[model samples]
Target: MATDALKNVRIRIERAAQKLGSKIVPDWMLEELVEPEERFSISINVKIPNPLNPLEKIPKKFKAVRVWHRKPDPADIWKGGLRYHPDVTLSDMEAHAIEMSFKSWIMQLPHGGAKGGIAINPYEWSKDTLEDVTLQFAKRAIKRGIMSPRIDVMAPDVGSTKIIMDWLRDYYIDYTGDNIIGDGVVTGKSVGKGGILGRESATGLGMHMALQTFCEAGEICLPKKKTAIVQGFGNVGSNFCKLAGEYNISVIGITDQFGGVYCPTGLDIDKLINFASANKYKTINGSEVISPTYMKASFDELIAAGADMFVPAAMEETITTSVAPKMNFKVVLEGANGPTLADADNILIQRGIQVIPDIYANSGGVTVSYFEWARNTRKFHTNPGILIPDNDETSVKTALQVMFKKNGNALIKVAKKYKIPYREAGYALAIERVAPDIKARNRMD
Candidate 1:
């Protein structure tokens, strides 16, 4: 499975480079483009009381990993998220890390790519136990040089949150005794704890902006019709669904990891958001209620729902070879990283279904995260404890310009220049930005 992830990224990188050829992108850089610079993983055992046998203790091992696809120069920092999910692995981290590099490069952030996450189900563990294990991960991570403000900046992802990030930040401050830059060690902290405003809805908002821009430019007319299916109701998916109606972009069907509600006509995004938020059965899946306007959806029904656009905000490898051919959408906006498999990508390309790639489409989270980092680091020499105000509307708009308008225009330019699709143009543009060799080659020409 891990190999598949890397292969998928390799396929993307090679294809992107193919458009430019060896003259502009040298052959030697392909190895670096396809492989990570370094990989580190740590696994430690923690004991929990056996559920049936309360007196007995059970030992469980948890793994946390970081992969650096593009190691930064001496003065730069490596940025990524620390996800807490059961399915996380080293290779998955590597693939996501490479995507981070691409995302940052295209966004022109002064940072390189890295990703790390610990494998654990936060729902199953008690808060006390979760905090203990998290602090343990933090102490060891800092000691081993796996995490630092400049070395590797952490953010929340998947099963992570602001509270968990706060715990990690405190531990780093204790370890380094540097009260100044400690908060900068991690973004996504609560605004009172040095987090930036608008971090939560950044990714979804960014996707919404990009999609709207495409519609407004007469690139796609789906927004006028509002026919779309949103997969995954987490931060990215839910926020996206909530904001789509602002542009009259209607979502006909939506699903989570377990199930969701589907309506042939547009479903009410606000009502769904409220229900999902109040749902106690976990955010992704809950018991469903049927109505004349909407019906409880099974996973199959949601995927089978036809629409002009598909927003996959759930997980990686969602659109497999079989799933790809069955897709009913004309455009796939990747809200989740690596949502489409390599073969699925080819199928989509062959079918003329354009993909708004994840590296560019869903970059709103990191884009706002960069805002948090810059804000936190700016106060490093001053009183670090002073909480910044949560005035993020302006910041969110700035992110829209950087991600949707600027990067979106750049992708169009590259696609036209190379006669390639947006996905290939995205990767090629990232490669062109990160590799100075292109400029050197162009000069020699």
Candidate 2:
């Protein structure tokens, strides 16, 4: 039986389609819409001679072993995240790959998704050992014709960071002797190394954008000036809080794996960042710290913590049936992919809470990755990048204002005509241009 999570995803997609007035695409139509490139043929083969190898300590973390897969996806090229955590499994990666396809389609990016992860915790391995294991995995995957810059792009995920990415990049370069995006093989690279201008803050920026958009649309004035409760203080959650502060959004509660801390008078992001940086995964709560109340809080309790918006930036399946009933927020923005389960989505929607789907919400990272690739491919040229010049934004604003005046609410009319989510509308505009090229490649005419 399909797990409740998967079922929920399908149900939400259907509901979203209905909301947009899009026809429930029959399987045959879906097959036709699925270009040949849409199917991915992956050949994943890895051999671990020692089942008991201390390094091969992943089987116990997940249910079974000998992970491998081959899937048919559009774009012919596969790209996705690779995570290492105690609960990693092949099926987990498969699901992520499916989301990547949908996400790339949503973002209008010409790519597909596939993810891989080992269940062993990184904390258990020394830096050198981790490097060796990563390189070995890379070599094995590469030799088997599985991973490559052109064939499949890989990025850091849970329990993995830029350091591991750097090591993998160097090892690939040494083996291939060809420049693979010159430190662009992996996204999320440190700033000095061709990483984009705001890469680290991209996820948070997307979350803020979602929250801001929701507030504007719903006209929900926060009780006390855009206050929020963030469940995970990892990269996405912490940076989100920090950037939210820049927008004058107050962050009240934050939790890390260890525990959470709260303060009504917004926590100091700089101090928390500095403390976490120094303490190596430890969370701080101002000068006066106490153990977190979040660890024991039900998922509903966590979201219903009297905040304007709740961000589940942590793990998947955290917001399931049992927890969705308790959420009291006006908006639930998912900073992490698939953070909310399918069943929970219906409940939240029925409650009239605007739940920002992951496809659009977390796309900033991939969008920036596309930027980094473009930069490297162009040899890091002096030309302007994705950053919209002030003049351009002003020009666009002026153009829209002029159009609105001439055709009074023309934008709204167009929006209603399309009957699409604003995010999907943005994507449709972009994909209309890219889809032609994708089609042209297979044209016999």
Candidate 3:
């Protein structure tokens, strides 16, 4: 259940804040931030094409979104994604939305955190079925006033993609009769349809940048000798693998939901990336490229195979207590949210393994989403009251890389001074950024 996961997330936040003493921090933030300000349970009673029978349609029942923190959304503030996974639930959305709040706050995006998902496995449906259901959801969302450019913005998540977002943006534009200019309503669209240049691989790029910052701060050199293992070759993991090789970091192992492979001499990420794209972004086989001896059928074998870095980019709580102790990595670059639970994280820290937290590490996706939002909303002459500057991939990367290095140094300094783990230091840093906003809005000062 998401309850255990939610508790694990909150406990870490509380632990970090308490070390700072709660006095300077606004009381309302601790009490209020834990609970979402808005909860949306959209009932999608629609008939979608069934793969088994074209004459009949299947019914989809539910969709959920949680707005953790934002001003009135018409201020065009909240930003997040809609995931389509069989395991998606309201509780999980709530947790992800809260994480978005932390991510946006730390990245200083012009957004608060919001997220929702339709609990369906997209793999079971045909392309037509997927598009029909996505459009239905988009129409329902528009009719209910759940989404708009001047309100909440949606992006891609697990089981979601750029084409899906393009559909939402297209529908919104058509539905509004071109009155609202719907491109800004959802991000991560095809670049031809208002998507930003870096949006495709922003999360992975952001993590890579953060990794470089942390490595520089720690005086670690990235060479071909530095091997890395990445779990999940989906968008985030695959993009990261492509870029990590640029720094001469050899990715020795890679795993998708179907299977994984390991090669101490480093696998060809380009080959695996192409294979996964053809296989729905899930890497199943690589024997044609990698030596047959390096194939790992499960994540355990890859963990057992060993590397200097391990990225649990697939799912939450993948690095549990048992997995934590078995990990051979010197550092963990969180490519997925909440991949390491509290207990497992403490285990890694105790073993002197550095953890680059997800909120900071995987923030590239939302950061670029911000750029897309700025670009899409640029046509609007209306005053929602904040001035967001123009953005492209290059300027965004330069500005954010500098911010990341500065923040990384600050977090390390605080971690050293407080004698706390890097994760805790990150939470403290995020809290410090968020507190002033919370205080000003509430007149807490």
lDDT of 1: 0.79
Question: How many clashes in candidate 1?
Answer: 1
Winning candidate number (lDDT): 1
* TM-score: model 2 vs. ground truth: 0.74
Tell me the whole-model lDDT of each prediction, alpha carbons only.
Answer: 0.79, 0.56, 0.76
By lDDT, the better pick of 1 and 3 is 1
Worst 10 contiguous positions by lDDT, candidate 1: 380-389
Writing each residue's lDDT as its tens digit, candidate 3 over 1-445 gives 5565677778877887788777755556687767678877766666765669978877856564445455422244778988988888788777788788777766666577888888778877678767777887888778878788877889999999998998888888888875445678899999889777777888888888888887777634445457889988888988888888666678888877777777777787777766666764365465444456565556888887778888878878888999988887788989998888888877887887888888888888887787678777774334343233345667666755765677677777778877888778877777776677677777776
- Candidate 2 — what's its lDDT? 0.56
**What's each prediction's clash count?**
1, 11, 1
lDDT of 1 at 221: 59
Can you rank all candidates by lDDT, best first? Answer: 1, 3, 2
TM-score, one value per model: 0.91, 0.74, 0.91
Pairwise lDDT winner, candidates 1 and 2:
1
User: How does model 1 score by TM-score?
Assistant: 0.91
